[model samples]
Target: MNRLFPVWRRCAAVWVTGGLAAVLSVHAYAQAPTQRPAQSATQSPTAWTTSWSTALQEIPRIAEPPPLYQAPAVAGRTVRQIIVPTLSGTTTQLRISNRYGTRPLTIAGVTVARSAAGAAIEPGSASVVTFGGKREVVLGPGMEMDSDAIPFKVTRGAPLTVSVDAGSDAVMQAWHRIAGRVSYVSSEGRHAGDIPAAAFNVRFTQYAWITRLAVSGEHKGGLVAIGDSITDGLRSTFGADRSWPSELSRRLAAAGATPMAILNTGISGNRLLSGSVCYGDSLESRFEHDAAELPGVHTVVVMIGINDINFSSMPARRGLDCDTPHKVVSADDLIAGYRRVIATAHRHGLHIVGGTITPAALPPAREAIRLKVNEWIRDGRAFDGVVDFDKALRDPAHPDRLKTSFDSGDHVHPSDAGYAAMALAAEGVVPGAKR
Candidate 1:
């Protein structure tokens, strides 16, 4: 068995093999730390901030509508009642994206307030959100804009309502489907300051336009969970924050463990090596933007590649050209992808934790491949740490399938109880986390 080298040694090897230019390129792509202006003696010290991202999803370019609508494409409307559960902060800011837009997106108005009830804001808690002191901002195609900090006390686990008036110019909005919460929308008007759900007639189960919520507070760093639909909380309950990452955050807070904001960057049907129109970019392609560049992110827990394996043996479907039918990948191919991610994380000084692929109800051939991959993850020493999700969710009797009680009926995704178990398995992998 090949022993894992120390992180420092691995970093040195990467520098020697790839050269300084390659190292610099990876670091730049990951947006590694740079020099910041020194604070003046008269000015107060900079406050620590943690960015908690509501993972972004790609709007599928489908020719036919699916059986159920996961998210609605809205234009010329005011999304008035977006409830986001936060961790800790004294002040808050928002990150909005037009990543997939073909034209400029205009924001007519924006506001943030504490939620009083369903679609209702606390009286006197409404605050106008501005961009660089401007009431409105225009974002071009494939662009993202961050709002100026709004002075608000954000209590842990409290929901904050963020309202935005996407003017008529805002078309084909990028949204995060499977919000697991309800958000209300208005009919082509600026009602961002509205306190009641009266004006907001339509309710949606996904978050629109907004991608990230950052808060200024003291924290050790941020934790990013990157993977596929399982990590995305697909089968999890709607309107309830029960994803393993969310549960893990609650556990950390309850235990008074390390102060780290958890950011879930999972997308349904996402793969490690390939991209699809509906599933967003591949892990390799979006890691920098989705996980690395985020503010104060120091660790990433990755659980990808299952789709890569499962989809390989499936028949090709329309709009999913990335997953070619009968294209089975060897364990080596998957391990190569993991190594690339690990190296990139190491170069950026972020600890990468590898997650063993959980067992699925696959044929013997595919199951064998999964076992190979998990074995490599356990003994490969490529990652800083390993979370044995396979062990956590697998049945002792079958050993190649999810436990009956833990299975979410699909034999792939985990039940709510299983998700909690997965979170527990990952409890102490986070740096500075108390056992």
Candidate 2:
């Protein structure tokens, strides 16, 4: 009876041990697939993305505006078919600004669509834009709002037309005056989602309220061109994106190199040291906002000071009162301003390339200062690199004047060919750009 009891106990212990091992193995097998999916969700490829932006600024109302600077205001009406160029991306957004408005700017509705023809949208491509998931947005004075991302695919260099209906409360609005492109305005109706070009009758050359278009994609960074009228595409064909910076963007894309977006922050009649109500803020004051703070921006190309030198000598030419202070600045003063720009850029970890002031028909006094400044830009080593714009656009026969072929007949600003040359000269120095 004792031997039988010992055998029974041994068999019972073996059976219990085997049963526990089998239970643990089944539990581990059940957990294996669940763990793998969680790991993969964390390692998703969609995590890598960037924002490419088009920077905008306020256009101060001028007292005696020229024919081209006459951009009308928006109130109780729909501004339809404002065409804008953007960098390539899978998703898109809109930035509306009221930075200089005295009252709250109320936007009733907005829409974006693929541009089909003049003031027309492609079929079934229009998307409603919202702010925080709401269609109506009210921006307080000196404020900017970004719309929620819409699932819209955009190709490089393709134009998108944005439509807006500014409610009756919107008054004293800001604008991009020298849009260099055509936009259509409707006579008091909410045609933001319409597809017909016939609904818009009043043709204009300005972008109102809309500040920037941001896109999501894979890109290294952005390149910003900060300058005066020359960089503003003054003489380039209307509605054609022939600005030097635009040309540079096309060149970069054609090379099939690493992706980089270009942002142009040029304002016509702008000066580097002085801020006039009509010419926007001075480069010294606006540097941080325009050049340094831009999203995905790492390289800045600067070309200014011609207006600083020219306007100082002839303030009356632009109908300015000669009594304006700080009109005349020496070469040293201009160089000092350049240094300040460099310091600000460096502090923000931006790689700045200085562009030599292009030649124009100037008085000897102004020309001498331009030469001195150019010499310092080339030899002083104050910038990360230098783009010799003077050498590129100046006539070898007469170094003080613009090449006759490149001149836009005003002895200032560049023709289409000249703008192309400027782009070529600077392409090699753009940060992360493949030369």
Candidate 3:
């Protein structure tokens, strides 16, 4: 896909070129960890726990990429993003990546400050973000780097304005598409410390470069909500913390449950079995990095397999066939996959929970698979615990469909209230969580 090893226009190997000359000279070095090494429990208590994060996907490789993949030009622009990181943090650190890029991604500088309003940051709260004690860093293909810890305070769900000034000639090639939050980009030039929000003219929701924000703390571990678009909180109200995981976070605070980060690692269209260029690597392939490898993740709740069951029916597109591997799945195949994931979590010494597939008004045949899978999830006792999301949002009258009040209108994704209900159901099952 010319994404990893770029295929340049070399057919014109300079047919008797005259005096013209062009040299692509870009030099920047990245200083960050590909993976934050897990802290041993017996070690010192001060460790890093991810405060907030979203999954990244290699942009769809098709020539005519979709509107969503048309990542805004960041070569010489400053992008100001409103990061929603309310998980506990005292001494915070950041992660950035060029994990799927052909061209190097470089940032001249990054500055974080308390968000005031749309694209506006609090005047005096700005702090510089450094890498290996330096301001600039470059990431080559398949690389992710974490920043040096910054002494900033991000409390329970407060918003943060992360301003990044792209190094000269940097290009973006990977992104987290369903940001479900608002962010802005400057027209041109560096605006990393622009507190007035005047230079940030362009706006977008997708997140680029930056990945995880972790805080070194003595707090309890976190809960990771990992799944498909439903878990991604798709179609939920934008800029509002309406995702089930967010709602779960709210409940934890209200109930006085042990304070832990509720990190969301769900990617829209992601599947448990098949891989897609559009939706990230299959969960079975990415589970380690996305879930098990995070610093202080103690529990993980898995809600997937719906896409694995339904994508087989989607008609193939001529260009980007995101539905490929159209490999139809049976209940047995999914149950086997779950067992593998469960074993992996156990190996990592993390407790894993299973969530029943929620209701989606599907045709009878496919619906059967979902029902059977949920049955196995409940009865098989594969996970350490279970969260019956289907029971929470399904219509009592129809069992096969979502409650009308819970439907996000497409009949698959959940509405805000529906997500809240999911959170409530999850609260009851996760031990000690009572709200």
Q: TM-score, each model?
A: 0.87, 0.84, 0.89
Models ranked on lDDT: 3, 1, 2
Candidate 2 structure quality by residue, lDDT tens digits, 1-435: 000001111000000111121111100001011110100111212312223333344554557666555556567777874544436787776677776777888999999898988988888988999887788888877776667776888676888878898787555445556778888877777888889888788887766777666566556667789888788888888778888988998898888767677778787777899976567778888777666665556678899999888776554545544224448899999999999998777666666778899989787888899999998987786776677888889988888888988988888889999999888887766554565
lDDT of 1 by residue, 1-435 (tens): 000112232211111111121121222223344222211112223343445676566665556646343455456778854554445777777777877777888988888898977888888998888777887888877777767767877776788888888877566545777677788887667788877777787887777778777777666667899999889887877777888898888888888875678878888778898876667778887887777666667778899989888887777766435455335687889999888888777766776788889888889888888989988887666676778888889999998889988888899998888889888877756665666
Model 2 residue 297 CA deviation (Å) reads 0.7
Winner by lDDT: 3
Off by over 4 Å in 3: 1-46
lDDT minimum window of 10 residues, candidate 1: 12-21
lDDT of each: 0.72, 0.70, 0.79
Task: Compare candidates 1 and 2 on lDDT and give the better one.
Answer: 1
Residue 370: error of model 3 in Å?
A: 0.7
